[model samples]
Target: MRECIRCGEQMKEGCAIRVEGSATGIIMSTKENAMFSGRIGYPKVAICPKCGEVSIYVENVEKLK
Candidate 1:
């Protein structure tokens, strides 16, 4: 376990993806100003070793229960 950046308490990762079977999420565009959807892509993510900060950028996804 690790502490948060704003608070020095035990921090756990909030869900990056909240929608089950959700294909897409928020996107910002300056030139296009468009919102893209209907594409299934569940990106893999992991937690930091020291801080327990989770980020999604990996190439593989793991299922845990």
Candidate 2:
């Protein structure tokens, strides 16, 4: 388990987490019921436990390559 950056608390898997990504753009059109015709952003990301901040870049996200 890894500790959260904002809260310094342990981050467990299978737990509910916040995700950050682009809004009305290309990425939005690929999601369920997606209606946008532009690039959205990243698929999804997790938020900070203490500050609840979402941090995830779609363009930079990969399979840990």
Candidate 3:
């Protein structure tokens, strides 16, 4: 479970961060050349309902290493 940084509240996880007019979500990579790198994963988002704090994270963190 994710916690809010600003307020002491449990955040809503498993959210997607997509472009304004696109269906594609944000991606994160460990290597500079993300296209050719296998160490890339979609980022998950967490939002705090209390303080409106947003946090972005990768669920498959092992892939980044």
Judging by lDDT against the true structure, name the best candidate. 3
Clashing pairs in 1: none
Q: Who wins the TM-score comparison? A: 3
lDDT of 2: 0.46
Q: In model 2, which runs have C-alpha deviations exceeding 4 angstroms?
A: 11-23, 26-41, 57-64
- Model 2: per-residue Cα lDDT at residue 28: 37
Cα error, residue 3 of model 2, in Å, equals 4.0
Candidate 1, residues 1-65, lDDT tens digits: the string is: 43545445554443354556777653332234332332223444444556566655423223211
How does model 2 score by TM-score? Answer: 0.28
Q: At residue 20, what lDDT does model 3 achieve? A: 100
| C-alpha lDDT (0 to 100) for residue 4 of candidate 2 | 67
Q: Candidate 2, 7: how far from true, in Å? A: 3.0
TM-score (all chains, Cα) for each model: 0.28, 0.28, 0.80
TM-score preference between candidates 2 and 3, better one: 3
Best-to-worst ranking by TM-score: 3, 2, 1
lDDT of model 3 at residue 14? 93
Tens digit per residue, CA lDDT, model 3, 26-60? 66667767655765677788999998999988888
Count of backbone collisions within predicted model 1: 0
